[model samples]
Structures are given as structure tokens and as C-alpha cells.
Target: MWLLLLLPCVRADSRCKSDLISSINITAKLQSDILLPCNFELTLFKSDMTADIASVWRESPCKSELVLSLNVTTALQSDVLLPCNFSPGLIGLNTTADIAAVWSHRNMTVNNLVEITLQGQTMYWKNYNRQIKTFSSVSASGNFSILLRNVTQSDEGLYQCDLFNGTGCRIAYQEMHLRFDDSPADGFLTWLVTAGALGGGVVLLVFLITIYICAKRSTNSSNESVSRELYPPEVPHDAVEYTLENPIYDAAVQSETHSSFRAEKGNSAETAVYTAVKKVKRKERKPEEVQ
Candidate 1:
């Protein structure tokens, strides 16, 4: 009966010793590189205290297995990244233990651990050149982050972390992706060029219209001038009609008078007889015939 009671107690003791690790918490914007933070708890002997951590790996939602194992620290060094930070109270593994971190796609690793000593902050990476660039964190106790910068699309992968300096290890994991985006400057420049073209076109159109108007006005002025020269204001004219029928008769009468006077002077009797015959002929003719 006592063995049975102890059996339940032993089972409870083993269960209590089991390590419980929290899942990594990660948040990031789309099209930006992110480092999914992974942290874990571990049970270790006092001799097993070192900065090196082990059993770090990564898994993706789309995959069923682990991808890359990080053993060499040099391999974890990013061309554009700073080193990671180790948790303080949980740090100091045995010197013989190697620093190992593994992830998917042969990219993730644990290079160094930052000692966190403040509150209200955590460590993360901004990518750079297809690798980690910056590591930053804030904690109330010790260094707590590895930051990366200038991440490229190819740097996207899954990551898992563990404090494995001892027999018992704590584990946590997160997902990360790197994204590349085109520059908006190109779009802006294109819009600028289009606007410039449109403005130029409008100005050109206005100029053309102005020229046309000026030309039309000039043509109209020239036409007016020509019209004035060709057809000037007119003057009124007065018209009358007259007909002459016996102008030569008047001249013949005068000549006859002069000749009769000259002949009468020479012979009074001949002249008196001629004058009486002439006067009788004149009385019988019309008044218009006498001239």
C-alpha cells in the first residue's frame, strides 16, 4: 500500500520536473524582414553554466521536419547582422558544450546572446543583405535580443530556439520572412513626367490657339484695309438732258442780216423790195423757225 502511494508521488515528481517552454511571440509588418524570437527554459546542474545554447532549430507551417542545424558560430555571423543576446539568469552553460542553433533554410542561428536589463522591450532583427543586420532588446534584467537589418526576400525561413546547455532544455519557436519591395520613387518619377508632359501639352495648345487668334485678327485687319481701298465711299451726281435742232439757222440769219445791210446801202430801191419779200416769208414761217 505504501509502494502504491509512493508510485503516484514519483509519477507526480517526474511530471513536475518536465520543462515547460513558452512559444515565441513575433509581430511584424508585411514586406518587411523579421526575426522570430525563440526562448526556452532549462534544468541544469551548477557546473553546466555557459553562454552557449543548443538545440535551436526552425520549422515552417508548410513543412513537417527541421531544416538547418547551426553548429559553427562563423556560419551564424551575418554579413549585415549583429550578434544575439543570451538570457542572464539562464545563461552560462558548460564550456565543453557547443553553441548550436538550427533553423530552416540554412540561415538562422544563435551567434551571441544580449544581456537584458530593462523592461517593456524585447529583441528582434532587421534584415540586411539577405541576412540579419541589427539586434535590439530591452528587459528589466539582462540582454534579451539579436537584431538583424536590411533583410532580403531570400532570408525568409522558420526558426526555433532552445537553452540546451544541460540535460533538460527549454524550447520555443517563431516564424519569419524577408520581403523586398520596389522603390516608390520610380512611380513618383513616372507621374512627374506624365504631369510635365501634360502641362507642356496644355501650354503648347494655348500657344497655338493664341497664335491662331492673332493670325485671324491680322487677316481680318488686312481684308478691311483692302476693302477700303477697293470700294471707297461714293459721291452723288446730278444729271440733266437738253436737245438742239436749229443752231445752224441762227448763224445763217446773222450772216444774211450783215449781207443785206451792206447791199442795201448801195441801192435803196432794190433793198426795200428785197426786205418786203423777206418779211412776208418770215411771217408765214413758225416762231421756232425765225431763230
Candidate 2:
């Protein structure tokens, strides 16, 4: 009996933990739809049964309060049912609630009001006109999404959404932005800068190459000209080197002639015959001329 009593007390304490669990997730785009998902887990204070389950929504984390609520017995096969028509324990309430998605730019607030039934049913409101701007929102997508038509700089700002029930509320927020299109002037300037740099580099390279080629050509021409100017003229292949032997031969021939002359003056027959033979041998030789 004591064990049973202790178990009930422990179970009761777990049920009323007082910590409200909620999470908000969103993705913001300029000219597109932004989806913000609201997920919550509720634990009843006295019992596990979701008899009087209530959720409230607020903004500013602590200041803004009571945006919406849900208070109906949800059908098992409804669209808002967590994890399909099954898992009845994941359902927040016995019935689906009206979830309102709000969008704010500057200080202007455009309320996109819609209802989502159990098992994720979405109700869209067409022609829900907001102010004239570069953005539009689809109020029918009960998934707390802000759909902007055309994005602009003026459309950039903060946005918020609130999901609630009878007990409390959960809030989700986001930001939007608009930017100007790039001008042709900017693009042209960029292209011109790039082209100028590339052209300058090419021109510099070509100039250096031309200078090098001219220098090489000039060097070769200079070498050839110098070689031509400094070279000695050609000479015949058969030219001979001068020597001292020619004078010696002339002296020898004159001495021989003088001796013969002396011998003839003396009228010696033997000397005359010998001189005549020597002169004949000399005439027959016909020696090469010396330089």
C-alpha cells in the first residue's frame, strides 16, 4: 500500500513540472515564402489526459502576450495530428485551433489570419490585401509562413507569428530584407577595370619581347660588322716567305763567274773546259725564284 502511494505522488510531481516546452524554426527569404514551424509539448498538471489543454503565444520574449489559442476536441484523423493520424499523445489539444501569422515592416503590421485543424489542415485566404509594397503573404498556409511576392529594400524588417491555446501561447519571429539591383554602370566599371589590367599586362609583355628581340638583333649585327671591318684581306695560297738564302746564292754565282774569267785570261785549256761544263749544269737546273 505504501509503495502504491509513493508511485502516485511521484507521477503527480512529474506531471506538473511547470516548464512550458516550445520551439520555433523559420527561414526568411526576400521574394519567397518563409515557413516557421511551431512545435510544443504539453503535460497536464493532474493527469496524462489532454482534457483541458491550453497554449498561449507572445512576442518580445516577456512583454507581448496572448496572441491566439486552441480549444476543441481534436479528431484522431485530423491534419494537425502529430506524426499522422496516429500518436494521439503528441496532439496538443482535444481540438484544432486558429493559428495567426503576422508580418511587420518598419512599423506597419499586416495580420495574416488563418485556421489550422487537427492533422495539419491549412486554410488559405485569397485577396487578403496588405499595403502596396514589394512583398506579399499567403495567409492560407496555416504553417505560419510569410510569402512575399516581390522583394525590395524597403521590405526588409522583422516579422512575427503566434500560436496559442486556452492555457498559454508560443511565439515565432523572423526578419526580411530588400536590396537594389546592380546597375549597368557598376558592371561596366568592373569589366573595364579588369580589361584594362589584362591589356596593360599584355602590352608590357609585348614591349619587353620587342626590346629583347631588337637588342639581340643589334648585338648580332654589331658583331658581324666588327668582324667584317677588322678582318685582313685574303692572299694567294702560293705566296712564299722571305729568307737570307737568295743573296748568298747571288754571291756564289758571281764568284764562280770571276774565277772562270781569271782562268780564261790565263788561257788554260783544262780550266776552260771545266768552267763551260759547270755553266751548262747551272743553266739546266732552272731553280725556283726566292722572295
Say which candidate scores most in lDDT.
2
lDDT of 1 by residue, 133-197 (tens): 22232322323334444444544443333333323343322233332344567578889999999
In order, the Cα lDDT scores of the candidates are 0.43, 0.45
Per-residue lDDT of model 2, residues 1-291, tens digit only: 999989989977876676756756666779998766655544334453444443332212223343332222222222211110112222234443443333333337664433333334444445433422211232223333433444444444433344433233333333333223455676798899999999999999999999999999999999999987776344331332223345345434544545544444574545544555565566557663331
* Candidate 1 C-alpha RMSD relative to the actual structure: 21.9
User: What C-alpha root-mean-square deviation, in Å, does candidate 2 show against the real structure?
Assistant: 21.2
Candidate with maximal TM-score = 2
Off by over 4 Å in 2: 1-51, 54-170, 175-182, 235-291
Model 1: lowest-lDDT 10 consecutive positions:
234-243
- Model 2 CA lDDT for position 289: 38
What TM-scores do the predictions have?
0.25, 0.28
